[model samples]
Target: AQSVTQPDIHITVSEGASLELRCNYSYGATPYLFWYVQSPGQGLQLLLKYFSGDTLVQGIKGFEAEFKRSQSSFNLRKPSVHWSDAAEYFCAVGRLGGYNKLIFGAGTRLAVHP
Candidate 1:
């Protein structure tokens, strides 16, 4: 069974400051990982994903993530934070082969401050 873990329950960052959100996964083999962001009362929107090839992937809204197999981690980073970026972020790992079933972490709530 595959699972994802987001250690940070909540994160607070000031506008224009750099931000990083941690994510870890457990899987038997190379896993398909993804980062998604959700605004209040909205659906989750895909931020980035790592399936194969590049270990470093770019996402929307100036977000990027690096996949480190050794640590079994895929952490999201943003060079500068914005007030509008405040939202709940989710890390997910999808099973290969079959359907689009994704195991998601508990989620990390991001709060932006001035």
Candidate 2:
């Protein structure tokens, strides 16, 4: 079984400030990790994904995440955040092959202050 945990329920950051979102997962094998963001009343969009190779994966909207196998963590980071970056971010873990169900965390809502 695979599961994800996002400890922070909400985070507020000033505009242009750096931000980091934590995510932890439990899985039997090497898991496929993903980060998705959803704006208010909008569908979720894929931010980034890590299947293999590079530990640090770059994502859209100036987002990046590093996979730490030892810690069982994949944390997302942004050097500088803008007001538009405010959204609900979800961390998910899934299997590699075909159609496997993705287990997602509750989600971390980011609030940007001007």
Candidate 3:
């Protein structure tokens, strides 16, 4: 079975600080990796995704992530955090066989302090 795991359930960081969210996965083969962010009571928005090519990928909202196939991990990172960036982050994995069935981790809630 394929699964996604996020080590942190919640994270608190002061405004303008740096941020990094960890993600790990188990799959039979190379799987599609993605990071998504959701505001309070809002739908999720894609932060980044790794499909096939390069080891690093960038996405909207000033976010980026590096794909490490060796460790079966794709971690999300941001150089600086803002109060507006406070939200729940989820790591997900999918199969490239057109399954489109995204398996999401429990999620990590980020709190930004002033």
Candidate 4:
């Protein structure tokens, strides 16, 4: 079955520090990878996606991810995290001709300390 797994259930980091969120997927073929952020009581915002082509993909809020097919991983990275960046991050995987249903991970809560 095609699914996504976020190893870290939650993470706490200091403000202005680098952050990396791990994501692993189990899919038969190279599927569409995406990173999304959800604030408290708010809808999820698409960070980035990787269909095919360049392995390194950039996204909004100064976030980026690298798709490693061999590893079946698409990890999200941020150079410097801000207080506003403290939210729930989700890793999702889907195909081109699927039901358009996005299967989200358990989610990784990021806590930023000033």
| Tens digits of per-residue lDDT for model 1, 61-96 | 999999999999999999999999999999999866
lDDT of 4 by residue, 1-114 (tens): 878899999899999999999999998765899999999999999999999999999999899999999999999999999999999999998866747677778899999999
lDDT of 2 at 59: 96
lDDT of 3 by residue, 1-114 (tens): 789999999999999899999999998877899999999889999898899898889999889999999898999999999999999999999865666789999999999999
Model 3's lDDT to the true fold?
A: 0.92
Question: Which lDDT value does model 4 have at 41?
Answer: 100
- Candidate 4: stretches off by over 4 Å: none
Model 4 clash pairs are none
Instruction: Count clashes in each candidate, considering only residues at least 3 apart in sequence or on different chains.
Output: 0, 0, 0, 0
Tell me, by TM-score, which candidate is best: 2
Candidate 4 to native Cα RMSD, angstroms: 1.1
The CA lDDT at 71 in model 3 is 95
TM-score of 3: 0.95
Which residue pairs clash in candidate 3?
Answer: none
Sliding window of 10 residues with minimal summed lDDT for model 1: 94-103
